[model samples]
Target: MLLEALTHTWPWYIAGPLIGLFVPLLQLVGDKQLGISGNLRHLCSALLPRRIDFLRYDWRGAGAWNLIFALGTLLGGWIGVHLLGTGEIAISPDTQASLHALGVHDLSGLVPHEIISWEGLLTVRGFVSVVAGGFLVGFGTAYAGGCTSGHAISGLSNFQLRSLFAVLGFFAGGLLATHLLLPLLF
Candidate 1:
């Protein structure tokens, strides 16, 4: 059934290659760079019109397709959660044990609610993880000129040196967060 198919997780081999194919497909179709961060500038340009020189161009010409792509992503997420109702994330046993060692006892949801809820957000550890971490991610994305998906997938596929450095920084940051910061907080 359609519902069953929607609920089931696609194998990484299938999903990975499908995602990998997007770059060439996009290049063939329109020679576009696939990235969500650029869409923010387009949206701003569309809204503000002429106050800022950067926002003066016709966003519709360059970013209309991307806007539609963003809308489709939102719609797909809605359908996945609301209609398909597939919620559980399959965490590996080793990863689960590692999380348990890190004082995370709950794995009922996609994320451990004990560490991510409103009550948790009030705690020092939660505040740092949720609030500070969010700020860092946003700031880093801007500083790097794009996000992980943009750099790792699209830019890397195109052999961009900037993206290569950005991806390396991302990995280093992730390692630091997991090995050093997470233990101190939790």
Candidate 2:
């Protein structure tokens, strides 16, 4: 019964409040910002033995907890999938049809193999979607100062005006990508 419950998706009401509570809990614990992009900077600072001013900070002191959090997230995902997952992606029929129209026939896994597989990586569409999209996301995260979880959850809960603007921009960009860019790419 516990495993059955773990395998199913939680309703937004239950999940949202839990996620919302995480911000205050995080603040109470460490007073650190919740974000994933900064981990890249921390990793670079720790690994790259360069005199570059940007990567010269004491990332160990600042981001050790964040690094641990990231590790836990990865571990949690692995456990959820390997131990608790039902091995079925429950995409709506309408969504499946829409994807099929876009030539994305294989919806067996979490992501479409048409765009994420090694064979797909060699295609122009895949190249643009994966490589270029990754570059744009990294650039956007740096420019915005945080990713969605950081800005929408933590920053907004803290009542930061910058995060409000960032969240709006993120939504607009997502809409544009979904409506305008995806059809053209596919």
The estimated TM-scores of all candidates read 0.81, 0.90
Q: TM-score: which candidate is best?
A: 2
Model 1, residue 18: distance off in Å is 1.8
Q: Which regions of candidate 2 fall more than 4 Å away from where they truly are? A: 49-51
Error of 1 at 69 (Å): 2.3
Clashing residue pairs in candidate 2 (N, C-alpha, C atoms within 3 angstroms): none
Model 2 scores a TM of 0.90
Residue 115 CA displacement from its true place in model 2, Å = 1.0
Lowest lDDT 10-residue stretch of candidate 2: 2-11
Error of 1 at 137 (Å): 1.5
State the lDDT of candidate 1 residue by residue for 1-186, as single tens digits: 976766777679878998888778878999887787767778778887667776788799988999998898899888877777755778799999998999999888656787788999988888898999978976688678788668999989879999999999999999999999999999
